[model samples]
Target: MSMAQRERQQLVEAMTAAGPEAPTLCGAWTVRDLAAHLVVRERRPDASPGIMLKPFAGYLDGVQTKTARKPFPELLEEVRTGPPWWSPLRPVDAIVNLTEMFVHHEDIRRGTPGWEPRELPAADENALWSFARRMGRRAYRRSPVTVVLATPDGKRAVVHSKPSGEVILTGKPSELLLHAFGRDEVRLETTGDPESVRAVLSLDRSV
Candidate 1:
């Protein structure tokens, strides 16, 4: 199966094991809420715009609240089966969801105590690195200092640029992906001026 598909399935499995009330890295969202958000994003495209658009947020929340009331098993089933064939998301599932699923999967795992980063295949790491590079700037745009993301093998991308100071973040591509997406608890090394490092690290609030 494709990496994105595999990640989705793994997330479903994790959610199933964690049950509905488990806490997630997504603010106050429980596992059920997260599942509802995932399903509504793909299944209810009419409501998806509200996810990132402030004006439509209440509508999106209403849909999510309704979806979250469904039997947890049904929510898991919908997530595992994915969006309908006619859904717009189906055509670009991998491109859009590779990072989304991976990040949310980690959200559930990391939210639980005693969790560790799972080793991913090289192909998956490469895909994540590419995605991070593509999305890094927008993800890190609010930072006060410039942000540079680097992989262990030396590949690097300038996520944000500023005049005063810069911070270099180094780790495996997957870990770097997690860091870029605001999972600051991931194991990573930082370098650059002490002030810059502090500024970058302090900007851990997720986008």
Candidate 2:
């Protein structure tokens, strides 16, 4: 099976095991709310646009609220099976869901105390690195300090324009992905001027 598919299945399993009221890294969202968001993202494209667009934010919230009110088992089942074949998400499933599911899986796992990074396949690591390289700049565009993301083996991508000083963030690509997406709990090393390092480390905004 594809890595994305595996990640999705694992996320569904984790959410099911965590139960509905469990906390998630997503601010103020419980496990049930997170599951509903995923379901709406995949199965309800008509309501998904509001998720990222400010004007439609209320609509997205309403859709998620309605979906979250469903039986937890039924919501979990829909997320596990994924969007219907005719859904718009199918065409970009790999590009969209791979990282999305992986991150949210970690959100549930790592939000609790005692969580650790998973040992992902090498191929998945490379895939995530490639995707992060393409997406990192936009993710860090608003940073006050310039950001550079590097892998242990020397792959590197620079995000944001050069400033008076910059911070280099190095770690496994998956960890870097988490950091890029504003998960402050991710393990990463930063090197640069003290102020620049502090600025980079303090950032926790989503892309």
What lDDT does model 2 reach?
A: 0.86
lDDT of 1 by residue, 164-205 (tens): 788888988888888777786688999998887887777754
Model 2, stretches more than 4 Å misplaced?
A: none
Tell me the deviation in Å of residue 42 in model 2. 1.3
Model 1 whole-model lDDT (C-alpha atoms)? 0.88
TM-score per candidate, chains pooled = 0.95, 0.95
Please report, in order, the local distance difference test score of every candidate based on alpha carbons: 0.88, 0.86
Query: Which residue runs of candidate 1 sit more than 4 Å off their true CA positions?
Result: none
User: What CA root-mean-square deviation does each model show from the true structure?
Assistant: 1.3, 1.3
| lDDT per residue as tens, model 2, 21-44 | 999999899999999999999888
